[model samples]
Target chain A: MKQKIRIGSGAGFSGDRIEPALILAEKGELDYLVLECLAERTIALAQKEKLANPELGYDPLLEKRLIGLLPLLARKKIRLITNMGAANPIAAAKKVREMLVKAGLNLKIATVTGDDVLEKLDLNELSLEGNKAIKNYPEIISANAYLGHEGILEALQNEAQIIITGRVADPSLFLAPMIHEFGWDTQNFDLLGKGTVIGHLMECAGQITGGYFADPLKKPVPGMETLGHPFADIFPDGKAIISKVNGTGGVVNLQTVKEQLLYEVINPFQYLTPDVAADFTTVKLHDLQNDRVEIRDGTGNKRPETLKVSIGYLAYFKGEGEISYAGTGAFERAKLAEEIIVKRIGNQFSEFRTDLLGINSLHKSTFGQDTIPYEIRLRVAGKARSIEDAKLIGEEVEALYTNGPAAGGGVIKRASEIIGIVSVLMNRKKINTQVTYL
Target chain B: MKLLEIAHSRAGDKGNISTLSLIPYEEKNYQLLCEKVSIEKVAAHLKNIANGKIERFELPHISSLLFVCHDALETGVTTSLALDSHGKTLSSALLEMEI
Candidate 1:
């Protein structure tokens, strides 16, 4: 008899919708549910929160997600894996324990820590961005290595019902269970590579579905508002089928799968996660009509010698302001408003830019025909050394209503500190992982 | 004809680089994409936004072309002051290229 496991993706990012995950838990009949919530700069901001309050630092919506899915997951006997423990896995695990007690469930939870390699990071190492020494960077906030599946595999071996981790590579969260359930060899690069292909495809829940694929007249998607996330049915032979829950709002086909296969990927022949150098070149996707796609033949080479570390540091404060102009001369008025801000405070900030919302904000450069519109919104933003200096850029833009342009209404302004992220490769031997049962 | 007529795209980011995937509506168009959508043309197309090198990779089986535009997303999503710091719209711009 062929053994198979069903895995569903709940939340794709930190701020993704809760309903899709609830739908998955309620209907997907999943063996494992994985929620990947961390982004590149998410933990650095969380580290700041942890510094302010010791009990803080996890995903803001972790409690809500558990409250929504725990009972359903418990009833279905679905194991859950998440990287929602952004900067503090221990604290996150404790919170989950409290939630389990409150829900009257006796699920064993585990926390995978030691992704925080801040102390272990060699300051002399060069950053992948500019090749600058780590010590030369400004006030460092967080340094986390992209951990593989070892810690997660350990948690599964300990019979954990729920595993929470910080800084585990997104694909690894999905790949760990395949290794645990199938008892696949650790050095089985081909199997791990196949698993990684599945992980990367499912990592963004709605992406492999129709969420990111719709174009007005060209490509049409059915139920975007109620778009259901995706799931995979895996076999012991390293083959998987990608699909979404039936009666959902999205389409799952070869197109969606292919788009996501290359999502955030540079080299398809060598997609390097912490686990394996997955080769998407040999992968084949067959759309089995009615929302089922069969994925086959994906393999990988040996894993990278070093793991990539995401280091966050306090960069600068960004101040921005936007105001609208209307009527026949709206374009000229918006242009004048932009000029006023530049002349007033351009020299105060290190970097500054102005964009007319409908005109050139996205591309930052003009493309297509130049036509004067009835309404245009002028946005002025700048990078400042300090918060106070950052505020000046917005202030100047807001002043245009009374001081510079006519009908510059709907003024909005904001200033926030920026946390910049850089990467450096560290020896995989240096990352000391620990898994603790909660 | 606009590349958008026969193909679709999605933009992705890692650090300062932007990755844009161009998949044709029909597999037959893959050859046209290979001939028209050269790295030089893409670099020229995104010259203003991405002031860096552009590399292209071909996926013959899938009939897709992946463009890795280096130094494209300003400094990065977190640090870049651009409204579209992730360069999510870069793919749309790529689709606007002539086929």
Candidate 2:
């Protein structure tokens, strides 16, 4: 007899409070909880941490989330998988061990990270040691081979109540537990695809359930402050019922699910991943009514030929500083402030670039930013191969508010550290993913 | 040669990062991607177009890139991404990057 597994998705995995996600997992009688954190810039941050200290660069959020979660989950006996170990799972796991023990929750945790070491692999041709097609570059700030779902499953089988990973594929966290609980074979492409899609839909947590939906979600059910992280209830047949933590602030509805489905999907007919690219278009979703959507008919196809690697490099110099103006004509004055700063900074620095980011521009998001607001918040950020050059930028930017037309009208914020930017020279290399339980 | 459109994205606090994938007409044409792309160069080029710092990230996959493309944000994309040797509309340039 196969075990039944349920799936849920929501956001807010990290923050001061995250109990709602855990509370839902407990209520739903779910066997697994998967969290997705870590993206491109995160990879860069992880790389920075790795360079600073290989022992600890993973997402700090997971640890905090686990403290609130581990005890409750240990009570439920639900297993978990997360890629929150942004750069170094081994280090993060060390912290997790302490948390579990401190929480008085006895549990085994598996921390997976060898992929972060790709930075040390010598790929003269840009081929990531694990991916054979990407071009290798002379320098990389961070590099990690996307791990497959099997790793997560292995951890679960080893009685690892909690699994902390550096950077497992986003969908793999949800699917791995499905593969484990249902005893689904890796060769079962159809079932694998079903699980993968479920994971994909839920990977963003609340994103699927109205977090980023084009439509609106239902009002206050439970756990609003929790921001609604997700959990899954999986059936042996590979069908999942997605939901969020109860009492959360956000709502999960049909539109939310649809929006997440369309995310990052290149070809609905050929959704690609090293594990298996399933045709999501073939899948069907039914409202099924009453806070549940039944996912069915997900067809699995051939796996994409390539695996992805996050290539990051130390920025030679990076800095962030902002200038703000208020009152009438303040916006124009703010605009001039940017030009004057850039012009003055340019006088002393060559190969320097400046950005005039407006708080309004940021608030509008992916659309027109200047439609409203007479006051503007400007941020001047740039990078250079030299730290010395970067410092000059901060000085010139400050000069604008003190000596320029907007003199003293602008408030300067603390500056950001100048860091070098790394680019990926495509490198594809082959990695032996075969792992044995330790 | 078959043309396939690809979409790539990354996620973070601001939200999920995405880009309209313009599949190269064929795989062999991928060589040109390297010719036209370099980290420092992409950063500089994006700055020229958006006049803002472009936060770029490398995506892992058989052959996919997940970029934030902070400034390239525009409406329902109207312009096709590929261009020709002389800077004409790209008719084809990627079978698969590696066939």
Best by DockQ: 1
lDDT of 2 by residue, A376-434 (tens): 66666554556666666666666675586654344453333322222223222454433
Instruction: List, for all models, the DockQ compared with the true complex.
Output: 0.81, 0.04
In candidate 2 chain A, where is summed lDDT lowest over 10 consecutive residues?
A360-369
Model 2: CA > 4 A from native: A7-17, A47-54, A117-122, A127-139, A214-226, A347-372, A407-410, A413-429, A433-438, B1-99
Docking class of 2: incorrect
Q: TM-score for candidate 2, please give it.
A: 0.72
Q: Could you tell me which 10 consecutive residues in candidate 1 chain A have the lowest summed lDDT?
A: A364-373
lDDT of 2 at A300: 87
Superpose all Cα atoms of candidate 1 onto the true structure and report the RMSD in Å to 1 decimal.
Answer: 1.1
Model 2 local distance difference test score: 0.55
